[model samples]
Target: MNEPWNPYDVMPAARSADPAAAGARIDALPVSERWKRRFRLIAKAGGPRLPNLGALTFGERMAVMFSVLGLLFGPLYLLCKGLWRPALAYSLIIVAVGFAALMLGLEMLARGVGYGAAVLCANRACALYYRQRVLGERPWL
Candidate 1:
């Protein structure tokens, strides 16, 4: 049996020799064009960038997806992802918002705000996780 060809085996040399191909490969990634551009910008800013969305491991992709959907499990998800600081911050914010809403007799508004905050926290967590794990960059959030 023949071994399958590995793209990485030739990537470093090919990328150096044919910049256009590298650009084409980046453009062909499964993510949106905007994200592709952002990836390039991130690379230029001295951060790591994946060659394509397919380059992400299954675990990494799942983590990001779960984080984005982490309204009910925001703190738990972040904690499991080893983002203790963010988890604590998000928990504190939710508690404070809940308390304020109760004191103001605006339970509905508080619930809405809490939901929004959860979504925002999840999004930020996803970005932070991607930067730290996939891009090999330090966490900033």
Candidate 2:
């Protein structure tokens, strides 16, 4: 039979028994320092689930607010993150929204709404990516 998921039993690298030392090791990943910081925050919270806006500290709240820029830069960000399927899906949804708004004489409002969807999609996709990679969550989810 085939092996189960996370077959290699992925675990943190070079982590000692100390919790602080284990958490601090996120810095060694190849991502930018900015991302390393975010990952550290995520690790502390037991991995990157969606942000509970009301529960966040100031720094975490700032990070959530900063991601709002995805409303404008969603396609580019999605592509860079190697999430091409979501990028394509968002483009199609936006086009449909624009067409519907034009028919309803509400084109301008539709632009805002459509772009806002991108921010939501970005957050969901990133969260799913992290869960799949780090926690070995099922592929279907």
Top model by TM-score, which number? 2
Task: For each candidate in the order shown, give its overall lDDT on alpha carbons.
Answer: 0.54, 0.54
The Cα error of candidate 2 at residue 19, in Å, is 9.9
lDDT of 1 by residue, 1-141 (tens): 135523223222212212343355545545565445544443333333334445555764444333544566767777775566667787888789889998999989888877777776665665554354334333435
lDDT of 1 at 68: 45
Query: What ranges in model 2 sit over 4 Å off?
Result: 1-28, 51-55, 121-141
Alpha-carbon RMSD, candidate 1: 11.3
Compared with the true structure, model 1 gives a TM-score of 0.48
* Backbone clash count, each prediction separately: 0, 0
Model 1 global lDDT (CA atoms, 0 to 1) = 0.54
For model 2, residues 1-141, the per-residue Cα lDDT tens digits are 134334234434332223255354544444466665665555554455444445568877455344544555776665555555556777687778878888899968787766677766656554444443334342222
Looking at model 1, report the run of 10 residues with the lowest lDDT sum: 8-17
TM per candidate: 0.48, 0.58
